[model samples]
Target chain A: MKIIRSVAEMQKETLMHKENKRSIGFAPTMGYFHKGHLQLIEEAKKENDIVAVSIFVNPLQFGENEDFGRYPRDEKRDIQLAESYGVDLLFIPTVEEMYPTKPQLNMVMVDRVDVLCGKSRPGHFDGVVTVLAKLFHIVQPNRAYFGLKDAQQIAVVDVLIQQYNFPIELIRVPTAREDNGLAMSSRNVYLTEQERAEAPAIIHALQEAKSLMENEERHPAVIVEKVRALLQQHTSAKIDYVELLSYPELKTIEQINQQVIVAVAVQFEKARLIDNIIYHP
Target chain B: MKIIRSVAEMQKETLMHKENKRSIGFAPTMGYFHKGHLQLIEEAKKENDIVAVSIFVNPLQFGENEDFGRYPRDEKRDIQLAESYGVDLLFIPTVEEMYPTKPQLNMVMVDRVDVLCGKSRPGHFDGVVTVLAKLFHIVQPNRAYFGLKDAQQIAVVDVLIQQYNFPIELIRVPTAREDNGLAMSSRNVYLTEQERAEAPAIIHALQEAKSLMENEERHPAVIVEKVRALLQQHTSAKIDYVELLSYPELKTIEQINQQVIVAVAVQFEKARLIDNIIYHP
Candidate 1:
């Protein structure tokens, strides 16, 4: 992997690749390399002539109380993993470089928010789209890889691509998870021994919700209540929210005849864990 | 010039040109085939392998009370003018085709919008940026052309291209003017014989301000007052706004040591005319 830091250099490299007709696949991350990160890189390498990975811990996405500072970092190990997965370009822009001044263009998310993680973290997805817009222009990838772990991000990004007419495809990869169904995340390291024991139940609750939907349970409220009850029974953590909303649209459905997501957020002692299952009925 | 209305076809055509290393110069306008529009196309042709012009009277940029419905368009003549200027592609997306549904991505301008036309027409620059974001993605130009008559648009667009890191260069073409010194615009067709006679004085006011600045006059308010007095004495139009501010930043200057702009908007009997002069000290 070739380490790159400046935005201008990255854009020049990508533009040269574009002129040569090489398909570049981009995998964007916040860098504490894990299985989920590697999976995205692996998928990008499989489908493109060049694989580009960006690892900037975007400060814009975090709220005042959220973990912007000390989110996570492992540059040495991240470089090793990226090189192992054959990443052609590794972008590591510092905060000063990425945002030399306050950006004049302000972006906001108008849809597919007001639910999931977005409900609690206002302006989170706005920050997300803002950064992604800059990155999309910088990298100019043929296709971009995103894991379905944060299902809402994928849906919002779909709108960004379609509405903005970005000449890039969004490849949705299934969420990389541990053997116990715990979604792989950098924040997973923050869980204490007791909280870690309870973390598996978040995914378990979502699985049950999906099973109930599969077996003809159609009432969204009923499913939500049941998932809340299951999580309450299994985990000592506080239940943040349990929702059954239509996929991508994230709207409350009276009849679950379309694709829906059963998502949950749990507040552990040290971290907030989120999990979801997209059900096709 | 080939006329394309479909977004998909335009993207495919532009993408093919992009891959083949053909430099695309985009000239976007709300068409009525004026000399100003032709001048932009002519300049675009000079700089790139392919010249693409889009005639979209973007509804997003117009206020509820603005002239969106009454916006002048002449497709036959506009097409002929583009072809006459050696344009390669002409994209004419209908309002419905451009906006198939409400866009999920929302953009807001946080800087350089509180003065000039942006202040009078709230949400105008936001919508301008939104449509341009879509058009920029679809056209993927090597350079985009804009007339300096709407100098604020050029300034805001400067922020857009810079902050978004768009790979396209912004070519600022000097304002095309009539023989009588009136800035050329399709909206000039709305002017009556008397209003048309009065329009040239707007440009005369800006020229006077430039001369004042050239003669070591530095107070922004002094230049603004002189321009306003000149316009009042020369024409019967209602002066919408008359101000002088720092260039691009659009911020008030205590002293004119930097490049500055003297802008004026006059509401004629039937049309609102805007013009500006960017003066370098």
Candidate 2:
């Protein structure tokens, strides 16, 4: 597989590929790959003549107080995983390589922002929109894959794509999970052994909420309180928020007659764990 | 030349062109094509395998009180002008075609925006950035031609392209002017016969400032005063602003030792005219 870094070099490669009439499918990610990311690459490879994956741990997306410094990264391991999925190119751009100079803000984010993860992490969606716009320009892919794990991100990206009229199709893969039902995340690596043991509770709470939702229990407040109580049982876990929101718009659901996402974020011993389940009533 | 109205169709056409190994040079304009806009298309035709011109009189860039309703537009005239310049494609998207849904309040605007035309016309730069970004994505040009007549706009576009890592080379064609030296503008249609006759004074003031700087007259305040006095003499012209600013960065230049732009804005009859001259001291 060809490993490219510079945007110009990637554009040149893309131009040649286009000249040869090769269809391109792209999977954009922040490195430290796992089964979740590999699945995306595999899916991309299935649909296009050439599959390219970009590993950019975007600094702009991280909040000032967030875990940007310790975000897990292993380029060697990421490349090995991506190549195994028959990826044709691995785009590994350095922070300076991706952003040679201090860039002017070019993209305008939508208002309301779905306000999911954006509530705790302000300007996060702005960062995501900015970087994704840049990537779309460079890759010029026929289709791009994104994990449903970042449900809020997918919603934001979808709106941006439609609003800006970017020539890309978004293909969302289901959120990959561990055997114990915990959603797989690069940040999960930051949890201490004890915290790791308690992390599964996030998923457990989501499942419990889904079961309650399925039983025709429609009170959003009641569902939230139960999830909050269950999460509070773990001494290491502190509930950041447990709320029921409209699936994609993420607005408050006055009545749970439509699709909804019951999501939870809990602070563990050394990290924050987030998980969610979608249900229709 | 083929005229494309829908963004989807334009993207498809662009993709088909790419697959055929065509290097597209684009000229994005707010219709009512003047000599300046035609020059950009001429440049595009000379440099590219295919030339695409988009004539969109974007509403997003105009303030509520500004002349959005009266913004001149003649698609037939523009198409003829574009075809004369050997343009391969003419993209004429209606407001509904471009924006099916109303845009959110959030938008992109450069930091140094409130210096020239930006200050006079509120939210103008944001509109320019938003529409240009959308056009760039839809057109996906190899190189985009911009007339240097709108000096600050050129700077804003330059910064945005760099920030977004758009795969485009910005070719700044020198500002095209009329025989009497007034910078050609779509708003020129609003000028009355008497107002139009006196409009050349705007260019004359700029030229005088350039001459003074060339002769070692370094005081920016003096230059500002002289230009203001020249425009004030024209009874029909209401001087909006006259200032000497550093080129590109657009910082207020107290002493003209480097490259500087003498920009002026005047309101005559119902039209607002802006023009500038770059001088090196």
What digit string (tens of lDDT, one per residue) describes model 1 on residues B1-281? Answer: 78999999999999999999999999988889888888888888888999999989999999999999998878898888778878889999998988888877889999999998999999999999999999999999999999999899999999999988899899999999999999998889999998898889998888888898889998998988998998899898999999888998999889999988999998887799999999889
Residue runs of model 1 more than 4 Å from their true location after superposition: none
Docking class of 2: medium
lDDT of 2 by residue, A116-224 (tens): 5778888888888888888887787889899988887887888888888888899998889999777998888888888877777888888888889889889899899
- Give the Å error, residue B117, model 2: 0.6
Worst 10 residues of 2 chain B by lDDT: B103-112
List pairs with backbone clashes in candidate 1. Answer: none
| CAPRI class assigned to model 1 | high
What lDDT does candidate 2 reach at residue B4?
Answer: 90
- List model 2's recovered fraction of native interface contacts, to 2 decimals: 0.69
Badly placed stretches (over 4 Å) of model 2 are A106-108, A112-114
